[model samples]
Target chain A: MTVLEMRDVVKDYRLRNGLRSTRLRAVDEVSFTLEPGRTVALVGQSGSGKSTIAKLLMQLERPSSGEILVDGEPMPYRGARAAAYRKAVQMVFQDPFGSLNPYHTIGHHLARPVRLHHPAFSRRQVAERVLDLLRRVRLDPDFADRKPHELSGGQRQRVAIARALAPEPAILVADEPVSMLDVSIRLGVLNLLATLQREENLGVLYITHDLATARHFSDEIMVLYQGSVVEHGPADEVILNPQHEYTQLLADAAPAPERRLARHRQPTLAAREGGGQQPLG
Target chain B: METTTQGTTQGSAQSSPQGSTEAAAPSATAERRPVTRKRRLFPPMTLKLGVGLSIAGLIVLFGLIGPLVVGDPSTVRDIGLTGPGHGFLLGTTQTGQDIFAQLAYATRGSLIIGVVVGAITLLLSSFFGLVGAFVGGWVDEAFSLLTNIMLVIPGLPLVIVISSYVPNKSIWLVAAVLAITSWAGSARVLRGFTLSVRSRDYVLAARIGGEKRWRILLVEILPNLIPLLASQVVFAVIFAILGEAGLSFLGLGASGSFTWGTMLYFAQNGLSLRLGAWWWFAPPGLLIALFGAALSLINFSIDEIINPKLRSQTRAERNRWGMSREQRQAAAEVTV
Candidate 1:
């Protein structure tokens, strides 16, 4: 089984100030292990360094001073080593519409990865592989010919997932993949990710803002706040019994039915007694 | 904590987060996009394009075989028979040359200069524009500076100075002068286009896919600009043709050249207007205007075809077919 680990990864970016520059640590000693068939949720709100972490793992941005290792070896930066590493790690970006190349057909999108990773595969084999990948994502075989713009949001996201999976990467870094999608189709995508994770035994770094869905989906939850992992544990433990103040705040902010029910029940009870209002839950 | 301000900006936002493909990449509307060709010069062409192309086609026909039809105008015919219904057809000038023959030969040179200059301009602009945008930073700054300097220079005076070295018979020299002066404006426009296209998500995705930079620049970036580039080529050709005519008419372009410009030059020099040789000056000038009109028509039609939003009809259609969120959901349900 493959294991992807980031050992004390700290990515610091330098902001320009005319001639002088100051360092800003984006991912401060953030560390996590993604084992095969397991999902690790990087839970954080906007500007919480969740995306910076995603970028670091995707190798789109480099960590300042840490080791991102595949198996036991540190990830290489250039040449065949980098290309091989890229083949093993593929990202499903946020904004499915933006992720896909609008000018190309869905087939061209899938073919690119397959061709890149499996150079020996014939044109016929690549075509077959693309069709198979589309089917796995529950997309119609006919969709392979359509452009990104022709497809709906859910359909485009599925295509993006299919494109990511084409290279047969060991680890899937899905960066808030469902956030930009419609609420109706979001569950379908989440379920698809879950199914794929189980079937392919792919290590998934599922990044998101909603702890509620992250609880249902991720095997492990790491609550990121202000560039540090404030809380990290097994999914149910984090959700059911949170220790950190920020985590508790997130839980409180989450729209739970019980809280709404209690608030509703309080108003009626007070009206029946014809008394002053009680405190809200 | 100071952590709030620490990583507030990674400067990655300046780079693309997702590396999106377009600024306002609206959905490719389903209904009428097929009106644009999947292949260049392909069928399923719009009525406007067809009409414009027909007009252009006739002018192109004139350029190609017009001289062959009437033979050489310089092969001096009967003199002093200056009328519409004479055996000389469009009648003879004071120099006894056939006006019809002059017009035919002039079309060949004028159209040739236009096409050659346009092609040269396209090559120069695309070279400076695409590479500069893709390779950015200092290279981009240099190209920007070059374009700005070229744009600021007085084009007509520059053309005049350059073409002065040009011999009377060398139409190519005149074409080259026009090409040098005209490319900067188009290059700037193309640079903006390249800058926009280079930052697109697909380009970034290609980079992540480990696609070679050259391949991304050539296959991916260049093809997207072809429609707009095609329109630019037509505009450049029109500019070059008119520039040549204006220069030659001013007696600064290729002397004795069988272009419409030289024909007008000769007509003016020979005092054809004062000498009652209406057929002498009138045909060449009329042809120039007609050719200009034809090219402009083609340019507008190409614009209409490639960018459908430019058309009022498409806008009206979009309004008619456009849906709100609930309506889109309803439509989705119906389709399902």
Candidate 2:
């Protein structure tokens, strides 16, 4: 069943002059459906409005046109309805550095959400729940007492995930979550997110520019270009047999081992022994 | 504390391309003696160099047990109240009031005005700014216009006109007027800053976490604005003190009060500056400068500490044994 649906979501931002103004279309008639317990990766280059779409889903930015519905009901833009939507739809931002509040401890960051979203949880229950969340993200429970500055980049990203999950959101919009992470730790975070998605039956909208990570993390891939989806399908099919020119260019740009080794070493020698084309392998 | 000191020491040592670890190590060791010891010597700001803090402390120490050592401030003397050879330390004023006693009693008023005015300004400006920034719409437009209008009006002249009209206004009432005048500029600046911070992703995360507007403003926005807001409060206090002095100097503050400003006002009318009665004017004038400078120094020091770029650039006077900029720059380049 489709849990979240965007029907022609269009967003425009106004640019000001001294006496005149211009409207720039950030998201142009973008439409997509997110199914239950599934992952949809919105793949786009910078300026492709993928992040705008994610914000629209989270209702951080309102759509200029069209409907955003959860369970076939159009979401309201303000007051109690907006509040309800906010509780249901959680977001993980791009810059892991700026995603968490710097002044607050990790436990303060997690507890507020759990207590607000799940009021039935007692003080001890909240404490236990926060610890469980920390553990689920592969962080030490003791680390909760520490501030965001005390944690490493990977650890901060995990805390962000834990905070997002505290609300037990139906739709989790992760905007380039692992892009800011080190390549070695990126897969682990991705795997954790995937695990949480299945266990919680979350409809995850994973937005990224990295086609390779998209293939690894997402079930269905939507290739957005210049504020519109040019190509989309099952992740493997879309990535392996890219139908559009932009998708082909993106697939060619994926940082494979052979190309990385070839930049300093030789591509011809490595290509002969099969270049790092298969990301799943 | 130990770990952070250890980390900083290690970082200084590991990254020391200029070979200044010999000097930086001891200072790092000195810094690690728990922030409490450092705080004991330098209690944030006012605890160390605040003339007001010291004067207030001294006055409190003396006031309760002061009468035992000295006579009442208001007590008049007819003769032999002229010279320093007598019992009076600061000698007597033209009205036969003891200079030292009057100074101590007057401090109570000044301190009260400073605290009352400073706190009022801080709370008012922060509220106005936070609301304007967070609510943002017609509310922002209305506040922006109001603050800008208030900013353009001559503050001192307005205070003079208003205080003159409202006869028998208390020191607290004068403070309220000053507070009302001073908050406009701070509100505008804080509003701009809060607007920027409110747009950050974490703020959105907090909103999505089901935080109310007040909680988001207090918990999310206010915490980040502390370093900025703290500096602002210090500025507000200095301004309030100076403004209070200015008003009193113009005879608009507490009437016939022995405040530093009132001292200046009375001295200007009474003592001929040409006659070298610098004794009357110089001390209080110097005290005003002292209060302003002390707050300014603490604010600048805090700015330096909180700001990493500034901290890196500034060398401590006590511990000047550090690598030069060229050396540090070379070291950072190597790291990159």
Candidate 3:
């Protein structure tokens, strides 16, 4: 079991606009802990430092300040410890099309991580593991031989998920994994991730803009606005009783069928009066 | 529990679209499989490629086999400065040396230099280009600076100065000089390509997968560069061959070797052109032009692989345009 912790992480970017350089704080004093078998949905709009936080967790970018700890131990920068950290914390990138190497087969993608983490596994064992991974992600075993272009977007995402799971990581950082995929297939992919998280007891950081899925899929919801967490609580409480104005705006933006039905059935007296007086105003 | 049921229903709903895609995939793969298999057996051979390969192949075959079948190129004959006839297929040079034998030997020698220079250029360019870009920072700065310096220096003048400085010049030395001068251009191209490729998400994904740096560079990045590399190598070979010819024609060619350039130099010295002994000078010049054209054609075909937009119109497309006015009118009437 692994507990991934981000202690007051702040990420800044040096932006240069020809001769005058300015600092842009992408993430500001954000802190969170991801315990095994739990999901934390990071809900935010575009340019809200959602990806920066994910990059920090994945060690793709270094934090400007503060520390990241794995099981109460500081994250290693390089060497065997770093490799171990990577194996423990894997990520599923947002763009499946871009994430997969077009030159390689799906089997090659999955088999690589398995072979990296488990060097003792034989070639046959690796092949078996790749097929097993394909099956786990609801892909046909035949997909192992196919290049990424041959597969649909959803299938490719499944392959990406399978590749992430190949090392049997304790923490999976899904950085808007389904945002690039079709809406019809989004729930299926999320459900698969949820199922896999449950099966392996993986700590998941599900970064997304869709508040409905955020509330439904995660145990806790963190509403981020302009690189800062505006509200954080139990998923339903954060959605139902938003404490911050940004969170309230976000909650109101999400289309709710029941709310729409209620509004259609009965327009409030004030709303009716306002509708009647709209042209004069 | 309700969400799980909803998810299952959606999952099943998801399969309908997936099933349509799955239905489409098999036929797509079916069309793709034979094409891939055919490609494995033989790369897509355009008319230009076919002609280029055949010409190059014939020249290479002549170089390989013609030397063994012919007599000594330098042997002095009684029939001095004769035209094509009298038991001499390409006649005699001004000094009575068999022109055919000299041409054969020159082709072989020139080809040797081309191949050697191509290999060296491939090594140097890929090393400076790929390694620097992939490893970046000061190393990249140093390499880019070196490449820039090399690029700015005029190639032929530098080569002439280097060749003039080195006495007892051999074919290998000349090849090395040509390779050193030509590699910088391709290195710059490779560096630009490598920079673009190294930052691609697949490469980043490989790094996040705990893959070693070298493995990611070799496995993730290198394979994508094969078409570009192949085209660069071909261009290098053509440059090397042409550069050597130019050097040899200036009488600064390898002292002992009988390259096409050296043959031209000897013919020029003997006043073969003034005497109207076209066999001596013309064969080598024609061969050089033909070989260069052939290699250029091959390079163009390779370029099409790198950028598909360069490919010419297909037969059907051309045929559509080729229809006469009557045929066009008939086709229009049929459509109506």
Each model's interface RMSD (Å)? 1.6, 1.2, 0.7
With a 3 Å backbone cut-off (N, CA, C), the pairs that clash in candidate 1 are: B19-B201, B20-B200, B20-B201, B21-B200, B21-B201
Which CAPRI category fits model 3?
A: medium
CA lDDT, every prediction? 0.84, 0.79, 0.90
Model 1 TM-score (2 dp): 0.84
Per-residue lDDT of model 3, residues B1-336, tens digit only: 976975787787765544575588789968986576445323489888899999999999999999999999999877799889868999998778899999999999999998999899999999999999999999999999999999999999999999999999999999999999999999999999999999887888899999989999899998888878888888888888889889998988899988999999889989988988888899999988888888888888778777877765667657777878998899999999
Fnat of all models, as shown: 0.42, 0.83, 0.75
Give the winner by TM-score.
3
Q: Which ranges in model 2 have alpha carbons more than 4 Å from their true place?
A: A78-82, A256-281, B1-71, B272-279, B312-336
DockQ of 1: 0.34
Model 1 C-alpha lDDT per residue in residues B1-336, reported as the tens digit of each score: 654543454343445443253323444444435543263444235666677788778878977887888956877655664765586778777777787777778888999899999999999899888899899989999988998898999999988877776555488888888899989888988999999989776776777777888989987788778777888899999999899999989888776668889888988988988878788888889888888887787787778757766765766667877788899999999999
Lowest-scoring 10 consecutive residues by lDDT in candidate 3 chain B? B34-43
Evaluated at residue A104, the lDDT of candidate 2 is 82
B-chain TM-score of model 3? 0.87
